[model samples]
Target: MESESSSESSLEKSMENVLHLQNSDNPGLILVIAPLNGTNYLPWSRAMKIALCAKDKIGFVTGEIKKPSKNSPMFKKWRRVDSTFWESNGPLLYNIKREISLFTQGNMPLMVYFTKLKKLWDEVQCLRPFLVCTCGNCTCGASKAIADFDEDEKLIQFLMGLGDHYDHVRNQMLLIDPLPSASKAYSMALRVEKKKDV
Candidate 1:
């Protein structure tokens, strides 16, 4: 009995780290939650970034380790995405350039990240996105940092709650795991594209 009660308490605490039900109010924004670190980060991120922009929806990216400074490598890349990733997707560069402000700028502690994420969601209430996608180990360290017990389940439950908060019909909140391969990311991107077409 004690073990089960402890488990419930742990789950609630974990949810608090990732989500605050009261703060959930984005009607149509497709929030792309993702981690900044990983092997296939570039290809996966680039693919989804292009796909989201191509679909004419703003990709509000979160879960970055640190906000890019003016002198950061990421900033430099953002400056020259056109020439750099042109072969892959030329127009996405333009789209990112146009919507660059939507992204968070700097590194933060996990707790602060969640706080700011909630605030950003509230601020962008008017955008109204078609889908909210999560990518590449986006449990926001729930499995490790937040709680060791049922962290994955807590993350999924939190996401599902967000879907409800955003009024998503079903399957609108996507989880793209790039560890399997970039193919999975591409497949997820295609789904987003097809959904946009409809």
Candidate 2:
């Protein structure tokens, strides 16, 4: 992934400059946190393309690698170990990139101003976050994958328990795809919540 966050990609619909995510002109909407990895579980990745079909705005933070050859052997080994979660939800491992930033160039901001960069996950949490979804390789390894169909559905039900619905509607789903790196297709729903901060 990229060391620093880059410009907002037209590849996805995002509104990184807008603050105050509640009481807008609309009813129910979502703020997605995509991992952009090519896995079947991470909703953040392009695997679940259908979920984005409905009307909504999405924000993006894309990482890139100019030279894959430069990474340590340990990184490659770690990825290989993680891909075992295809059949079910396992403990997720994080390969947190060095850092990422907002996708807009709205106006002039000095290093200090930019450092005031408060729009990361802390800000996301402040929004009362209706949905928090992630999909990627299994946490333990392929030997411990969740391969049963019913068990998979149970995982979805578990995720739904994470929050409440924002729309007068229930079971809100999204699928956005034709992503550049998706290895398989996936679908997920993240309930919407309004801003919870003062």
Candidate 3:
């Protein structure tokens, strides 16, 4: 087993490689935050890929790295975690290297979140996204509220703070809330709002 420091270092290196890959333009970034193992991750990721590719003028690419098939000896070096992938919705400026399952481990110390936040903050500075979208609160139930007692609150705060800080600094930030595809909750909220408007 790799030490925590080494694991984090490796994760950052992988992200840099992905981000540095060639792309026609830099559409800035759309940072999606959700549980590493949650059921909604894959769908939300794919949907975001498609939406960005379809509508955004910038170009991007997406790829997945899961367990290598037994027949392919080249994949022997791939990480044993779940299928890690990135997809280009259409064309975008930057390639998204997902930071999945990296910080969600059990018994992690507080510094872990800070470290992740700093890394993401640096990414925002580097990518200079015109927009930063988070798919965070959409799948969350009332049970997942950001109260002080909740262990996940630290992560949640960091994710939210990333967008806020980016906006404050650049003054060009546009956050696309809970993409409409993730949950029925968004539809339900819209229904209530529509009823009120009528």
Candidate 4:
């Protein structure tokens, strides 16, 4: 009987620990100092792990803790933390793609418009990174081909998002034998904007 009561006490304590949220814990809490800017993924991920571990919430990210049923007492807090940290690929990916599809330069300056679109593009790349060739002896050049295709797609998207005033410039860019890269395209557009300003 004593052992049974002790076991129950231990279980209750564990549940309490899992459900507890400190004053600092909230949905809007920023987990890492530096955001994952594609290039610094290693250090950024390490920092995130340390932060989540400190909060005793690493299990949620690591998949060690399964999501609780809606009626479960832990469900609400679990959801809040999960949404804050976890970048689930489905809905988030769809939303980012939709934003990119709809993005356009209206009244914003060329630099401002390009910066915003660049951010969205970076997020898309981060979320769906290009797959590296793993086999050591392969020589098909498929990886490079895929990368070139990706760049071309981005170039097209960038051209498509420009204002109607850039129709002539956009048409000229599309006519090039080898289309310019997205950065080059941006520079071309900036020149046009500057000429107009003058």
lDDT of 3 by residue, 1-198 (tens): 569989978865664443332343233434344422323445655665665455331233323433346775424334321112233332221332244223332343324545554454344333333322245554644433432223343334343433222333222212334222212222343354466569
lDDT of 3: 0.38
Clashing pairs in 1: 28-128, 28-129, 29-129, 67-105, 67-106, 67-107
Model 1 / residue 30 / CA error / Å: 6.3
lDDT-based ranking: 4, 1, 3, 2
Q: Report the C-alpha lDDT of model 4 over 1-198, residue by residue, as the tens digit.
A: 999999978965775586577788766678887876544656877898898888888887666777878997777866776676666566656877888889888887779888988878887776685676666544777777778788898889888889899999999999987888888999998998899899
Candidate 4 or 3, higher lDDT? 4
How would you encode candidate 1's per-residue C-alpha lDDT over 48-81 as one tens digit per residue?
6775455322222432222246975454433333
**TM, every model:** 0.17, 0.16, 0.19, 0.59
**Going through the candidates in order, what is the number of backbone clashes in each?**
6, 18, 18, 0
**Over the full model, what C-alpha lDDT does candidate 2 score relative to the true structure?**
0.27
lDDT of 2 by residue, 33-108 (tens): 5543323233453433343322221211111211124364334532332232122212122221112222322342
Worst 10 residues of 2 by lDDT: 178-187
Task: Score residue 8 of candidate 4 by CA lDDT.
Answer: 77
User: Cα miss at 59, model 1 (Å)?
Assistant: 17
RMSD of 3: 19.8
Indicate the residue-level lDDT of 16 in model 4: 59
In candidate 1, which residue ranges exceed 4 Å CA deviation?
21-25, 28-198
lDDT-best of 2 and 3: 3
Alpha-carbon lDDT of model 1:
0.38
